[model samples]
Target: MQQLNVIGLDQQGAEKLGKKLNKLLASYQIFYMNVRGFHWNIRGERFFELHVKFEETYNDLLLKIDEIAERILTLGQQPQHTYSNYLDNSSVEEAANIHDGRECVESILNSYQSVIRLQREILSAAAEIEDEGTASLMGDYITEQEKTAWMLTSYLK
Candidate 1:
C-alpha cells in the first residue's frame, strides 16, 4: 500500500532503506518476543521484580516495533515478519534458550545496541535520499531503542 504522499527520494534509495529497516524490524520483533518469554518463565531471587519490569519493557518494545514497521510500509514496502525472511536479513541473532536473567540482559543490551546502529545507518541513508518520512521513523526508533537498552541494562547495574 502506497502511503499516498511520496517524497522526492530516489526509488532505489527508498527500496534500500526499506530493506534495511525491515531487517531491523524483524530482529526487534524476535528480541521483544524473547523478552516476553523470559518475563513469563523468569524465576529466581528477583522473580517478581524482574518479571514485572520485563513485561513492561517488552510492552514498550512492542509499541516501537509497530511504529517502525509502519514507517517501513509507509515508505512503499511491506515489513517482512516471516522467520525465514528475518533469519536471512536481520543482523541481530535470535535468542536461544541458553540464558538466564543476567545473560538475557546482556543479550537484549547487545540487541538494542545493534538495532540502534542499524537505525542510525538507515536514517543517514534515508536523509541522503531526501526521505524525510523514513528519516523521522529512524530517529524515533533510535531514541526508543536507546532508552530500552538503558532500562534493560539497569537490571545488571
Candidate 2:
C-alpha cells in the first residue's frame, strides 16, 4: 500500500516532486544572483531602465525561491541550502560581469528558457500523480515567465 503525506499526496510521488523542485530551486537561486549582478553592474545609456528592471526581476525570483522551498518542505523533503549544492544541481548558468544592457537581457532570456522548460516538465510530472498544488504552481510560473520573456525579447529587437 502507498503511504501518503500530511497533504494527502503519495509519499513516494511527493518525494519525486520534491527532488524536481529542489533542482528548480537551485536554478532560481543561481538566476537570482545573476540578476543581482546585472542589476549592480549594468552600464551604458540604458543603465537606469535596465537596473530597475533587473531589481524587479530579482525581487520576483526571490519570492519564487521562498515559495519553492516551502513547497519542498510541504512535500516532506528538506530544501538544499548550500551554494555548492545549487551550483551542482542548477541548470541555469551563473552569469558574471554582464555589464551591457543588451547582454543582460539576453542572459535573462536564456535563463528563462531553461527555467520554463524545467517547469513544464514538473507540471507534467505533477499532473501524472494528480498533484494539483505542484501543477498549479508550475502553471502560474510558466504563464508569468512567458509574458516576461516576450517583453524581454521585444526589448532586444
Candidate 3:
C-alpha cells in the first residue's frame, strides 16, 4: 500500500508540496522584511497613508509566513527557518533603504505578482494530489493578493 501523509495526501506528493511551501515561506520572509522596511522608511506626500498601509501589509505577510510554516509541518516536513536559507532559496530579492512611497508600493506590487504566481502553481500541484488543505490555503492567498494588487495598482495610478 502507498504511504499517505497526515492529510491523506500521497507521501511523495506531500513531500513535493512541502518543499514548494518552504520556498513560498522563504519568499514570504523576504517580502515581509521588505514591507517592514517600506513601513519604516516611506516618505513624501503619501507618508501618512502609505506608512499605515505598509504596516498592514507587513502584518498580513507575517501571518501568512506563520501559516505556510505550519502547513509545511502538517505535510510532514521541516520548514526552513534561517535567513541564509531564505536568501538562497527565495526568488524575491531583499529591498534596502527604500524611502519613496511610490517606489516602495511598486516593489510590493511586483513582489505580490511573484508570490501570487507561485501560489497558483502550488494550487495546481496540491489539486493534483487531492490535498485540499494546501489547495485551500493557496486559493485564499491568491484571491486576497489579487485584490490587493488591484488596489495597489490603483494607488499607483
Give the number of the best model, judged by TM-score: 2
Compute each candidate's TM-score over C-alphas: 0.85, 0.98, 0.98
Candidate 3 lDDT over 4-62, as tens digits, reads 97778799999999999999999999999999999988889999998898989999999
- Summing lDDT over every window of 10 consecutive residues in candidate 2, give the lowest-scoring window: 94-103
Model 2, residue 79: what's the lDDT? 99
CA lDDT for candidate 3: 0.93
Q: For candidate 2, give the lDDT of residue 24.
A: 99
Clashing pairs in 2: none
Question: Highest lDDT among the candidates is held by which one?
Answer: 2
User: Which candidate model has the greater TM-score, 1 or 2?
Assistant: 2
Estimate, for each residue in 1-157, the C-alpha lDDT of model 2 and write its tens digit. 9899999999999999999999999999999999999999999999999999999999999999999999999888999999999999999999988798999999999999999999999999999888999999999999999999999999999
Error of 3 at 7 (Å): 2.3
All models: lDDT? 0.78, 0.96, 0.93
